[model samples]
Target: MPYLNITEVESGVTSLAAAFPATDLIELPEPTFEGRTCHALRIGTHRLEPKPAVVLIGGAHAREWGSCEILVNLAADLLHAHAGGTGLAYGGTSFTSAQVRAIMEKLDVVVFPLVNPDGRHYSQTVDPMWRRNRNPAQSGGNPAAVGVDLNRNYDHLFDYRTAFHPSAPVQVSDNPANPDQVYQGPEPFSEPEPRNVRWLLDHFVRTRWFVDVHSYTQKMLYVWGDDHNQSVDPAKNFRNPLFDGKRGLKDGLLYAEFIEKGDADDSAVLAERFCEALKGVRGKKYSPEPGFDLYPTCGTSDDYTYARHIVSGQEEEKILAFTVEWGMDFHPPWAEMEKIVLDVDAGLVQFCLTALA
Candidate 1:
């Protein structure tokens, strides 16, 4: 199964709305950068009141074109669920509209769908593995500085190291025209792309499930990015404490993440919560509690969402957020990707459904 090109994904989003007119779809204009205009999709929120919002974003990495497809397919499934009055689907499992919508009402569902449009375009047109923006900042003598890793450019933990480039690694970058790895540029929030993400997160404070979909890792990561947060309070309170006292494989994964970070406090019990929410799935494989731990990162969407909720001064109370890394190279012809989409989509939607319910 070939991955979806950007235009095909856009058409998919449009078709979703066409299929379900009761749902309102809005395309948020992207801030202009280097002469091109950027934009994102705003879906749902039609008849539901102050619904619990979930932000679904994808393709921050240039080469991971499959993420955009997974998102589009999920949107299409959601549309079908919308018009047909069925619940969200998995291989054989189905969660209901009344059940799911009841959960969604608690949090309005907002999906960015795809973020690195230019990089994505570059991937489709120029390089299959391109990872940054189309801006010229990465060109000239600084060719390696091609694309600012949009994922790494966020205001939160802006200096946190990336999983791939702990220190800057010079490769034939996806945005080949650019230079600089961990090249934050002349100023903070310098890139309009990540800044837009900041603005988007700010726009929806009540979001219960915050997901930034990416490829290459078959894992879902949650809150308190970077060692900075750990060193600061050490009070797991900064996270959304939904997974406390939870059990099972999924919970085990969540617990292992927390336990490893030395954050075994009550707030670190998210594993339990995640597992509880995922209790219905059968015949699925999940890692048992392992000593293998996820390295901490800063300025991540996860940390930002958690911070928004935990801090009440100007932010909303703890809203749940997770960085959903579906799998490496899960791009597709629909058949191959469906399992990945259906599996993670089930978990992502169920999280929101439970939060809103």
Candidate 2:
């Protein structure tokens, strides 16, 4: 099948819920700037209390067409396999029937296939390179100033100028006139897209894992995006005011975000499992690394999800977050994206299995 259009993607969510007995459709509380209602699917057995949840979201960047497809297909595969008592085969990687059943029974697998439908609709119809949600609050009648980079609108060092050193290579901008696509919104969680994601994280209090799916890097990256990770000094972290202007300097000893040694190790271990599972599908080697290894990014989804517990002083469970950049282009052809979707679906299946264990 061709890449799903924005309408079909939302329809896919509703159809999945309608077709499957174990799935429930959750309407996000707010509509997008374009008045599109986004939904998430909760796939698990109905119970009194919640299970340890795994949230896999996609379509953050409008041009990355395959991310949402991968997630929708993954949800379908899991539900079908569990119902039929069969296994799932994606190229060479296969998941057992029991394993699929355990995932359905033991964990609440939440798949939000599309996060920015407005941007996606615009990209599919008008500009294939569009990367932000279609919110014109800051547009000021300039056609180019029509959107906010939803990925960078999260609440992790969102004030990049104050959060990073002058020399750091952070790919974010607050200027509406600057045509670079990574506009970090007027404020943290300013756009409805990121706010909807935040709602999922908040409403699903037991969500322990998150993966904000993206494209074109073939990487599975973990947290500490603001700078290199350091487990030694807990006081020199993102929440600490002492290191406000010292972050984002790669290869510099001035500041490194502090993650617990065990948490850091767990992040790396799960990243490797995702990479390995993807490799098993088609022999495509995916690098597992820290998010800062790519570049300094403030207000990214992965960093924000993982930082919530740290910034909240242990009030919330620490979500082991990741960004799985699949494929080698923002929007690959259907011939190529079809394969990448399977590769990522296999990885997500493995990720859920690992979380269950």
Candidate 3:
């Protein structure tokens, strides 16, 4: 499958609503730097009422075109199954018509297939590796200095003092410039793209699951990307109560501890199920791990969504968030595109089924 341009993706989403009258194609109020419209496709039954909801977002990093395809195709498959009164079989698990309809009635699946339209257009038309939004404001209105890494522009754990240099505190640039690939803008939610995402999360009360789709790493990552510890309070001291005095450091370090144990465990199990479904299709393996385990990144969408409930003292309402990295590389060749889509689509379907269970 050839990578879809911004216009094609938008049209594809709109066409879904046209093809299936039950589906809704909503245009987000915020526009990109290039004046491209941001759209979200809401599909499933009981959309008007509150229900268990899943939000699937892609193209946050414009060059990861595969993510967009997987989401759009998934939406299409679901709509097809629902409208035709047919079932779907994936990863050896059968989703009966009854089960599918039950999920639709009880779950709302909203997909923002393409989040950064301007950056995606730039990547597809101008540069094949453009990883940020085409926001020239970061570069002081310099056209060449365009882009703000949308992934890093979220509100959770935003380190404006340190900027892009995650490891070192060494001052590189006085201003928030795209000097490197991971420029985190002047402040959190600085870019409109991610702010729109935040808006969706805020308004959608039933959003229980959130998956930020990206390409190339072949992993499913869960929250707390800012640091090793999962605790919302950075200064909170932690000591392993179970640690015996004889084994190593007596003073328990406040590192990599999960603030919410039950939530973490449940999220881990769901991710494992997703990986299992992926392997069921052609035996492709996708590792399930924490986001910080891969690398320490601040202000990621996954962390922002997951941590919001915890920070707000609403642990029961915490959204189970994950970043799904599909395929083996950012730009998987056309030869592998279809299979990649199928594999990911299976995993996603399994994820939705798990929600119902």
Candidate 4:
């Protein structure tokens, strides 16, 4: 079970759509810095109708091989089960044919398995630990500044110095030299990888759920990445300029991102459900926690998706966004990676089923 290369993964998306009439191949408008185009598969019964969509994206870091594989497999399993009218079972976890059909008929399961093809190519061929996109325009002739951390290039609090406390452990760097390996980029959405994700969400319009899949931690994380979540103080939120310098502080009262009590509860419940399903598929223990529990991050995709309705001033549902860090390493052994794929595919099936409730 060797990992699929970037070409194979991209071709896999096209193959899924070609094999299953229910799946449509979505061509992203922007090409990568290396002039490589990205593709996404939208699977469902109704392609034109407005419906709830569960967007599963991966390969942002490039080195995390399992993320892309898990998503591709999930899409294949759903399409296969729906088309054949057969049940899908992964180890101890099983979904009936009816459940699979409901998923296709009721929800749009959009899988963007590879976000940074150029970075993935570099990681596989040259650097096994490469973690960012290969865009050297801002490198300033410094070899180390060859890439921008796609994860930190989103627009949510891109200005970390103004948005976070001086002592906050925010992981972002503005320097194009990018020595920290977590550069925030010259501006938000500066690179095409993250812009592709933003475009996908905007194009879909009805996407109510989003999961930016990553690795090296067996955790299911929910929104409010910059600070602890609080529903009590609406004015002390990320949009409020008054709390700019006080944000991301661990001191409870100092600052906390505001999320409505119901939204917070929904995020927690769904995350727990996702973890529970993954555990059922081979008894892998996956914990549900806040995104900040990993660290205080700025300009992350999950936080940006969750903040869309609040910040965009557009008519959109408050998306319940998540980040599922699968397995225990960036690149796990192929034998172990096979099992991890099944574990997460099962979890995603349960997530789609739960979304209908």
Per-model TM values vs. the true structure = 0.74, 0.98, 0.88, 0.98
Worst 10-residue lDDT window, candidate 2: 44-53
lDDT of 4 by residue, 134-195 (tens): 99988988878899999999999989999999999898988867566798788999999999
**C-alpha displacement of 68 in model 4, angstroms?**
0.8
Give candidate 4 regions above 4 Å deviation. none
Candidate 3 lDDT tens digits, 227-300: 34454543331222332121111132423435566777778888998999889888888999887667666678
lDDT of 1 by residue, 79-105 (tens): 567666778757555678886556433
Residue 235 lDDT (model 2): 89
Model 2, residue pairs in steric clash: none
Stretches of candidate 1 off by over 4 Å are 32-48, 103-106, 138-140, 159-182, 228-292, 309-312, 315-317, 330-335
Candidate number that wins on lDDT, 1 or 3? 3
Rank by TM-score, descending? 2, 4, 3, 1
> Model 1 TM-score?
0.74
Compared with the true structure, all predictions reach lDDT values of 0.55, 0.91, 0.77, 0.91
Candidate 3 weakest ten by summed lDDT: 243-252
Q: Give one digit per residue, the lDDT tens place, for model 2 in 246-285.
A: 9998778999989999989999989999889999998999
For TM-score, candidate 1 versus 2, the one ahead is 2
Between 1 and 4, whose lDDT is larger? 4
How many pairs in model 2 have backbone atoms within 3 A of each other, for residues 3 or more apart or on separate chains, i.e. clashes? 0
